[model samples]
Target: MAKKAYIGVDGVARKVKKGYIGIGKNVYGPELLSTAGMPFMALANKYYATHYHVDQDGGFATLELDTLVSSPADIIGKWWPDGSFGSDSVETMITSRIRTAVSYSGLIIHTEAYEITEQTVGIARKIRKAYVGVGGVARPCWSGGELVYYGTATALSVARQHLAATSVGNYALFGGGETTNNSNVIDAYDASLTRTNPTTLSAARTQPAGTAAGDYALFAGGYGSNYSSGVDAYDVSLTRTNPTALSAARTQLAGTAAGDYALFAGGYNSRGFSAVVDAYDASLTRTNPTVLSTARCDLAATSVGNYALFGGGQISSSSSSAVVDAYDTGLTRTTPTGLSTTRYQLAATTVEDYALFAGGNASGGYSTVVDAYDASLTRTTPTALSEARYRPAATTVEGYALFAGGFSSGGYSTVVDAYDASLTRTTPTALGEARDQLAGTTVGNFALFAGGYTGSFSNRVDVYMVS
Candidate 1:
């Protein structure tokens, strides 16, 4: 009898031919279930599998086929080979409930570093759990538990938490927030995603907004002993400059940068919800002009390409709002586009071309829904965060957009949900401490979440590597 070994695909021994073995449905190439390219093949009753082969280069190879289904309802409750939603995952290319189309969600599970990518997913019949890697690529060994949404554990943090953030070149910088009696500290994160204490801001304040122009980074308008009109500027060398004060004193505003100009718009001062906009140049000089159509506070602001978008904040009638305003580099304002959901105290960021508004207080209380928009301000399908929250900090690092620690219905939270271009959400790692009212920024692939109120006040800063 010819020597044979158990084929991993069907659990039946097959005679080894030279260095290769032939086993699988239809006896197709090892990469497929069928010659026509169906990755799925029938196994036990109601059980199907997609093949995974460990390449000689140590990478896992699998099929990403578009297979047709008679109706969307057919795959409604069906589980994918990797156990993630085959049809329902937001990043899934297949979302047809029913159509002339097909689905491709089950083809790719996740890239793993198990050093042991198997040839069969027929474990659908024998197992209910599996291992998944965390922290980007897995190392040489298993470093994960049972498959879960976000592989997270406690990580390190800076001494401060509620600090403001802005990026210059490949570094994310945190500056000026409340700790004990509002601090003027500055912590800079490098391209490798490490944090170092840089020069502190001249003025101490909390809730200041930041935007950068070329090599110059500006921090403006936060609460000191009281609402402030102060504007402080920093160069790439970490040197400081005192610019002309903002036209009006304010706090809790939205800010953005374009060209060499940075604009701070809409905030609550003693006047309560002012529409004032403060524009600063590379020289650290101020220009008070062009107000937001709606005056509100606690809004989120981010710049995409040549435009800055301000979205969702508190109004006089109520704190929760969905109003979004877009501005050109020339400071011309377009009519605000209402967000799909009305919420205030949300956080916003842009990853590549897509701008996102995530987590805030809505009519039903805290929200997890994230709204994505284009340059024209049109909204796309929204995704949800792992947890509903308010006052989360938002930024983009490498290719990932992240919303960090914030206040939820349960109180201050440390959950950090990272988003991809498709609004796919994942938890990287939680903050060292649970906090809210924090600020975040990205430099290249480095991210920093810093300074916020955690019961008392904290100066802790948490950094993450996005690449």
Candidate 2:
């Protein structure tokens, strides 16, 4: 007599080989019973699935198959097997809609993990719910099926303004600003949102430009005792070192990183407003790149994809300039489409595929304009800020680019405007204090707004967190 077992097919129990199993749309048959089912015969030769279970509805199933060579519990930390999307180490897995491993333990249905950008979690609710079957392609995990976030406040060790900020590895550093006097203070916030004060800068200075390349955050060229050309580099351990100095000493220069290079460009030097550019590679080796098309100070800089852009600055004491200079990974320079309004003191940051320049003094008046440039350098105008302001500090966390605390007709603003990856604008909680000339940076899931003037120097650090 032929051994037979029952499997639910389309909600009906059907007789099949004893070793046969079904998972989602894939059915498997035992080696000896390879000819048993017409629909499953082709796959039976390929998969040696000895163990499986299906619910009466047949919509949910679990299977132990030979191809994976192990059980789900053993598969943790393994790269998901999919060629088209490449792969990522499985960071986590969840079994239910509740979305947490601890909360959803009772649900038998399991979800598979993939490495999609974590910020995509906000849009995850629009995706259809799915289940995983071993040896079959699984849906990519976005935020492990749900989203939640909270905010925390941390204070900078020192109250300061006009500082430079950048994140490298696990640390967000705010360096060189105005305190009671020029500040050498370098305040750091780690991934856990804990604050620390690292070694002070080599010189007390204000308006230094900060950017990161490779593992180091470099703060360069600001006014100290005089227009200074010093460049300080900090590695992952928060160890600081003086790198080769900038080609020229300057203040209010625009700094941004692209590819392996940290670039400091266009500022007022001792000579006059200068168009010089200094580039530092991963090893802190300095190189002089072709200068900006227009020499100006207070230009905002940010990188999207392969290009770093420096845009909108004060051309002279009387006029602002709208010219935008772009540099690719190779250090080749080009001019992208200019800003919609000629403005300087605008804030710039990158989120997802867009680099945004927002709100600055245009000609003489505070401007609310927000110009966005996609990876191709194509420019578009997003919604204007709710408030007209200039010199707002900007940074990105998750998919949100936040422009916070700037000077306006009303005085310094506490306003924090956030633009999501889709360019939609939302107002998050305002800063803990009304401030301008602050420094903004991010570490882990937190966006930190720290150090600015609010009638007085502010050490207040408002952190926005996304989980």
RMSD of each: 16.8, 13.2
Q: Clashing pairs in model 2?
A: none
Position 441, candidate 1: lDDT: 76
Error of 2 at 140 (Å): 11
- For each candidate in turn, the TM-score is 0.65, 0.72
Candidate 2 steric clashes: 0
Against the correct fold, how does model 1 do in TM-score?
A: 0.65
What is the lDDT of every predicted structure here?
A: 0.65, 0.76
Q: Could you tell me the TM-score of candidate 2?
A: 0.72
Local accuracy of candidate 1 as per-residue lDDT tens digits, 170-286 = 667777776546777777766665667666777788878888876778888889888888877778877778788888888888788755778888889887898888877677667
lDDT tens digits by residue: candidate 2, 392-450: 99998866789998999999998988887768888877877899999899888788888
Query: Model 2 lDDT vs. the true structure?
Result: 0.76
* Best of the candidates, lDDT: 2
**Model 1 lDDT at residue 415:** 94
